[model samples]
Target chain A: MSLISVGEIQAAAQRIRPYVLCTPLIPAPWGDRDRPLFLKPEGLQSVGAFKVRGAFNAIGRLDAATRARGVVAYSSGNHAQAVACAAARFGIVAHIVMPRETPQVKIEATRAHGAEVVLCEPGRREAVAAEVVERTGGVLIPPFDHPDVIAGQGTIGLEIAEDLPEVASVIVPVSGGGLASGIGTAIRALAPAATVFGAEPELAADTAASLAAGHRVDWSIEDRNRTIADGLRSQPSALTFAHLRQVLDGVITVSENEIRDAVREIALRANLVAEPSGAVALAAYRRGATPPGPTVVIVSGGNVELGMLAQILTG
Target chain B: MSLISVGEIQAAAQRIRPYVLCTPLIPAPWGDRDRPLFLKPEGLQSVGAFKVRGAFNAIGRLDAATRARGVVAYSSGNHAQAVACAAARFGIVAHIVMPRETPQVKIEATRAHGAEVVLCEPGRREAVAAEVVERTGGVLIPPFDHPDVIAGQGTIGLEIAEDLPEVASVIVPVSGGGLASGIGTAIRALAPAATVFGAEPELAADTAASLAAGHRVDWSIEDRNRTIADGLRSQPSALTFAHLRQVLDGVITVSENEIRDAVREIALRANLVAEPSGAVALAAYRRGATPPGPTVVIVSGGNVELGMLAQILTG
Candidate 1:
């Protein structure tokens, strides 16, 4: 199997430079004395997630003919919006396959970026996306498994290393593992002294289990859906699992309560909004799951429903 | 009678560049289709407010002999923290006179920055600050009204002009008017076409009343304190009043309900925490108080207490 390399990630950085935002690495006020925590708020991205980086890189690298043929993606959250936004930027047709049970806000946000939305049964998203590609002759932009997508996400690691070379540890939330896989690879290549760890909710800790077992572990969708972190419900793909095994130092799992508290802490202390999934790394850090040093916690996204955020803040 | 000119603001920008953050002008996703709104989040500063600009500028400009003498300031909120943080950076002593009723968090934050805090009665902060200056022989860094402070605040306007040259209007929250005076001077000098407007809480509309009467108008402290925006209780001084009359096009006063709604909107929509006082500019813009244009709303600070932020978000 092919793997994403640092050189490709550097190229991805250059390719998506004009499209994505260079989000600030803010110092969190609540950091411990010895280990200052820096927040990489990817939530500040235009599409409110780091998925935009992978989406833009994957779409931008397509040849002229392939680009004109259009793109299709399967996602129920940030990836859908990222793909839609990136496709809109490239002036290419995009067909997004989202679960019918997806939140109205996510669906609306994806549609707002000028993509045709095709709703499917929760587990049928891939099949639907495949059908769309078969029917429309569109290129499939896999959310995380694709090498180009992983390379794209790795750009964030490049930025972290460039901005804070002394970063001793990086805590990234893992879902399908695109972010962790890419970021881990980049940090390994660019800042070898920095250890990369994956954060996951206990309710959906398939990535942790998979990493520990040294193989991809399948968790029922119903089991994964028990977590409030909707974006992290999916298990890692084979490609992402392979990358994670190589690059990640360990996987840290946080309780749902910890996740909610982290979201609140980020909002209250850092003055930045963090969706539940986006806040997992912070949750892990707050729980003292990571090693001491200048730690970087990736606040992955902020496209949460307002009511949920209000509830978390109030609670 | 000397006024803070744009030249002074430019110089202040250079002086404080090494100290203060060059806050990003983020595009508000909730902006109107016709007139987009941008947020200059000074709350993201190290001190969690734009007060750092003035503090750093005023203190940094001191001669080595004077700097060695230390600095003194009177504030119960962001300014105290700003002064403390700036003084700490310069490795000079900071004497901050705060109201006895100041929150423990603010007091602790100020102390954490190595400032010596002296608590006094609510209305006696100035008197206590004067006593501290006399005792310590430290230079007083007045919260507002001083030329250096105004020049420091104007750096925000210079940044705005540089970032968005086509910016048509700037809406700034008016407290003692240092921020508005500085920003207005910079915008008028740099981006001549951009109109400057001050946002005030209707409950503490001293600046609005003063501007309307074409002179300084005093409001009782009790009357100004009625607003939820605690930082906006002080009336503008003669220096700030003169600058407001010359530089501000108009003042927009927002109701308490509007201010609350604005705080919520900024948190939910923009993913940025904004104190009630800091959110008044966005509140005014949302209420259509300003003329239609590409508006820049200064989110003055994010130094709000967590409990209060929770209440606002939930309510």
Candidate 2:
């Protein structure tokens, strides 16, 4: 895939202007050891994650006829909720399929946003989503693959460049590689001097393996499910893999412990709530990856369980 | 004291442009109820509170000669740190007198910014700060007084109006009344339709009393200061009182239970580590303040103890 250009990113910004927030690029806490940390607070985005951008962009582009039939998506939380929310905004129905173990908070929130949620066994989410889409004649919205979704996600990078063009490095935590790929594509073109690194939890290092091996790789969910960074569990999609190939400088992995510590560090030092996945990038930066100078860390999401939050903070 | 005008606030926004962040106004999570709750997020300001606006606005106006004598202040934490940090930016010597019980984290953070730290008994904070000013010929930087401080705080109201002019009600947590007075003044001027309610902890309801009695009321600092909302314990200053009398629509007291619950609500729903004082305004809104339609809560600060945060979240 050709890398996303600055012009494209600027266009994405314009397209997403009505639906997205120009999320602030805030300086990290003053007590940091190295150069300044500019946090791209994606947590402040609509639906409380960067996923909304992609969700809205995709849903917005659907033909009126298609929107009338609604859309279907499968994910544990962020993407599932984002598409559901975007559908509601456009007055379209959303069918979200999630695993049975999906958190009650996420399921209820997704349902409340006008999504008809279908729960399935861990291994059957995609099958369940496909069945629903087939039965209902609904279009399936892949969490990360579609071009509109990628463009929507790329808008986050546009905001970053507009907000802090002088950023030295853009560190983004990776899961299905959707966010990292989209942001990296934009940064490579808009802020050429800024290096982009994809961060992954050590427990869920499929993206790192793919980067190392130069091919798409799949790691079983159970194999990478040890980390509390729930959002980092997915292996990269083929589309994201292609984009990462062109734009990302490298992939870095942080331990589950590092991710947890970084989450606490964000709460204590930066005074922000960072979910485990969101903290991976900052964790890699703090542990001294591609460093020194103006670092931009994408704080990916803020959807955390109350029990987990207490656990993270108290411990 | 004359109320700070909307026009003046616009000017202050320009004046302090180089010094502080026009902190992001973050929207609460989608499940965050009928009236959308947008936070002014004073927590993200340069000094981690809205105090920086007042501190820098005051410090910015000092004559060159007076600036050389440096700035002196007294507080338990946030304002002391704010003054110290702001003074550092202008190359001014900051002499901060804090209570002996002031956390070492704050004391070190202030001193790390090159401010002189003087620790005194809790009751002697004001006297020690006065003595330091008198002996050193340093200008006393009142934590929440003077025209510039009010003007600085008034900038928040200006931003609020600009960000959400149609907002129907604003809930501001009041301490010494600097923030409430300035925000109220600006809100009334710029967004005349918005109702500005002062939120206070019932345990430290001095501002509520002062507003009712038409004078500053001294609330005992030693009287069961067990409420997690530590920052709202101060009595209202005369300058703040003068502004509050002219601007605030009403004052509401939140119980200790409500304050903790509010803090938790912000953490869970808003995904922000709002300090107890910061959560008070939201507490008022959530605990039934039927002022108007759309409500904007000024989440005042993010300085919080990790243990306290854990306790709040667990409950």
Candidate 3:
């Protein structure tokens, strides 16, 4: 399949304009680091994460008949909340099937967005979601595995190009490779001079493995995915892998300690509340994994647990 | 003492324009509040507080001859950091004498901004600051209560008017009347239809008492200042009192527990970090003390101790 193009990203941007924020990119002070760094603060987006872009884009692209059926998603993370938030804009009913083990804060936050949350046993969330679809005729909106979702995410690249103008490199946290591929597609088409790097915690380096193998690779769902960066452990889907291989310049791996440090630094310096997964790009930047252009790091989300934050910032 | 003139506030906006963020005032969507509350995100300012306005304004309005003499202040909190940061922008040397008990983070942050930090015993900070001035030929730049500082703070009022032309009321956290006077003057001049409200924590109600008494009234600096809202214990100065008398339409006070709740709500809903002092406006709003207006609350700062944030967010 052909990769998403600038025109598709442009169209996606237009569709999602009403639902998402043109989140500001703040320039890191010249003295704080060895090189210039700019943060694309997706943490400020609706539902407080970059997932809003793809969620809205996907929702907007849905046919009129399909939207009448409402939407369901299986996620206990930013994606679930993003879909819930975006669906509310269209007055669509959102049913989010989350794991019972999900934090009370996340569940409450998701429900707070007007979504009906169905908490299920961890191993059977998807089955529960499918059962709901069969019962209620709700359309399943998978996170980061569809052409439309990737196209929607590509719009962020368009914004980065417009804001930074001469950005030499862009770093994104890779969970399912959706964000990276989408942003990579836009950069390759609009800002041809810039390189895109995908960041993943070393403990959950499935994306890197998938890239090296030139196919979708799934590690044991529970094996080696034990990093505190909870948002970056998703296995890459075949559709996203195809696009990632076509657009991404490279992937960078970071350790758990590095992710923790980046989160703490952003909180202390930038006055941000970055979840561990949200800080992987900063982790990569701190570890010298960036390719030395006017750099932009995606601050992906800010749903960090207060308990986790205390442990990190007390140091 | 004369009230801060609208002309002075207008001029201060130009003077501190380069040093501070005209922080965004965006629509607020938290819980189920439908009355269109807007957040004046001063917490995003350079030093993570609106105090930068006064600092920058005070520093910028210095006579060229006086600026060459440098400046000094005694603060163990956000005001100290704001002055240090704003003063550094003009290449002026700022000597901040903070209480020795001040958090090391504040000490390092002030030093990082190129300000010379002098730590002294709590009761002796101001005394030490005066001694430094005698040695270094520096002028004392009080954290608030000076004409230039009030004028500088009024620039925030200018921004509030510009950002929310239709605002019905503006609520501000009161440490000193400097912020209130500046904002009240701007609101009275530009948004003539808008009411100005000064907010204070009940635990440190010196400002409220001063306004009632028609003069500066000192509370127990030791006992009255024990609230988690560390920024609102100061009594208004003659300069701010004059402006307060001319411009402020109302004043409200919230309990210390209410301040903590406000801080947590602002963070979870606005995707913004606001310290206890910054949260007093929201606290007032939640307590039904806000006037019948589309209210804009000035989120004053975001410099909470890591331990404190843990306590606030968790409980």
* lDDT tens readout by residue for model 1, B111-161: 989899999998999999899999999999999979999999999999999
lDDT tens digits, residues A218-277, model 3?
A: 777576448888777687787888888888888899988899889877776676778888
Q: Which ten residues in a row have the lowest lDDT in candidate 2 chain B?
A: B25-34
Top lDDT model: 1
Worst 10 residues of 2 chain A by lDDT: A1-10
lDDT of 2 by residue, B167-244 (tens): 888889888888887888888988898888999888888888888887887778885255568788777777788888
Give the true-structure RMSD of model 3: 2.7
Position B228, candidate 1: lDDT? 93
lDDT of 3 by residue, B165-266 (tens): 888888888877788888898899999998888888888888787778877788877966587777776777777777787787767989888998897787
Q: Which residue pairs of candidate 2 clash?
A: none
- C-alpha DockQ of every model: 0.47, 0.67, 0.41
- Number of the top-ranking candidate, with TM-score as the measure: 2
C-alpha lDDT score of every prediction, in listed order = 0.89, 0.82, 0.81
Q: Is candidate 1 or candidate 2 better by TM-score?
A: 2
Output DockQ, candidate 2.
0.67
Between candidates 1 and 3, the one scoring higher on TM-score is 1
Worst lDDT run of 10 residues, candidate 1 chain B, spans B26-35
